[model samples]
Target: AQPRRWPLEKHEYKRYGRQLIMPEVGLHGQLRLKNARVLIVGVGGLGCPAAAYLAGAGVGTLGLMDGDTVEESNLHRQIAHSTARVDMNKTQSAMEYLQSLNPHVNYNRHEFHLTPQKAIQIFEQYDLVLDCTDHPTSRYLISDACILTGKTLVSASALKTEGQLIVLNNPPRPPGDALGGPCYRCIFPKPPPAESVLSCGEGGILGPVVGVMGVLQALEAIKVLTARAQRPANGGDWSTNGATSEAAPKATLLMFSTYNTPQFRSVRLRSRRADCAACSAQSTISRQSLTSGSLDYVAFCGATAPINLL
Candidate 1:
């Protein structure tokens, strides 16, 4: 006789026991997590902690994208890459740690900077994306790619004790869909002047500021992944009663600061902008423009001259 099969391996029940027992992430939710694919771009301060939590939660597949190698300076905030792993590609270093955390998760290492040409093809492979990068050009590229491929984006950034979080292109609605949530461009129609852009290395980033944002990114991702409409009561398909739905989540800009009296605040965002360049009905951005090098995002953002003496 054929051997009996189980929905989850026996060890998995014990491994994800805590979350597996919660209504928010019961058996069904755990299964969703196990089947989902998430890509994290820029495995630095924000990506490190976010990847750790998601890996522990059993996200089936994780794609880590980064071109930079580990540096001693990264130790202060990039938690996954260790001192021993210094000089290694960021994705490889992070994957080594994540594998130890959860042997069950499948990891892909994209060891290259994200470019407009490469964004769509890579974005298509994953269910969702985390924009852990700290620059605006890459932010626009990520958002546009997520919109084109119909994938939600959980993007966050931290610099000099301040951090902000936003989920863009949620529900993965296609271009011209009025019901679609806003893309990054809809909120900030223009990138900040290139001269004004500052990297964490240049301006400095507080360790916990980014750590908090990254953890929140993982939390939001879990919410999005496990969110299921309540099934008919007659079926009783869910393993437990805790998995229930609420009204769809609103798109809000979450701002954080450790020094502020009120450390957390949210600004509600408009749904979709009809005139938005990326996701709107009259969008000027298209797959062709993105892939053809005609878009010229770097030029759009401008390249600042090196200041020999600031």
Candidate 2:
């Protein structure tokens, strides 16, 4: 629950030996991961692979958030769930797998859907957040919470054979900071038409498609945490996760398609919008509005509510 006060165990040095050798994740970087608290807000396709890698990498605190239960249908793409785990709370199922992967890492099980009232409180406990949920409503809610909590966000989604990824709220500066990266609302002020929204259950995703996106989410998270390992020397603060120095890096959106001229395309993103309601200077969103549930994310986004099986 706190930055690791002790040192990595002797086993950890060997466990993370491969990454420890890399300049990107040297001894100090490995320590950053051990002291990191990461939250994954969905234990489905994307969250599964993302959590696996983070656990394997020895992230100290791994928070699994989901209200759904595992089912036979999820076995195809939800790699962490086993046949025996069917009908188990998703967060519980993931915790079992992740804990097994690395018993040294701590695990938190949040067996509830992320609502506006709980978003900020939950996000405040973690240093970084992964938006692995499938719906636009959840995406918007997650982003807003991350922005409000000043936590960096690694968000991704997959449908059918395609997946998209974007990192938001980097350097997680307070609203109005020109150097801060954009939030979900800045890039997508309006959600897609309700009729256009479709779940993987309806659209059909290939097993590997979503998994790829999830793995990429873990990679970005490591980059963010490990980058912070070098921050103390540069005077970067904790709010930014010390992912970068004085200024936030240019934001970008990565698109991956199973069938395309190029499998990967990187699209540069503009800085936080001056009027973004979530992460910009002229914003109207606040902790009060979020906690009071004044805004209806599902209605606003016109997306299907996730099935609540918990």
lDDT of 1 by residue, 97-202 (tens): 9999998999999999998888888988999999998778788888888988999999999999899999887766899987677889988898899879988989
TM-score (C-alpha, index-matched) for candidate 2: 0.90
Clashing residue pairs found in predicted model 2? none
User: Where does model 2 exceed 4 Å of error?
Assistant: 1-6, 228-249, 303-310
Over 4 Å off in model 1, which ranges? Answer: 1-4, 230-250, 305-310
| Residue 294, candidate 1: C-alpha displacement in angstroms | 1.4
lDDT of 2 at 104: 92
Model 1 has an lDDT value of: 0.87
User: Mind giving the per-residue lDDT tens digits that candidate 2 earns over 201-306?
Assistant: 8999998999999999999999888885244544534474544456545579999999998999999987788888888777888999989989788778765554
Cα TM-score per model: 0.91, 0.90
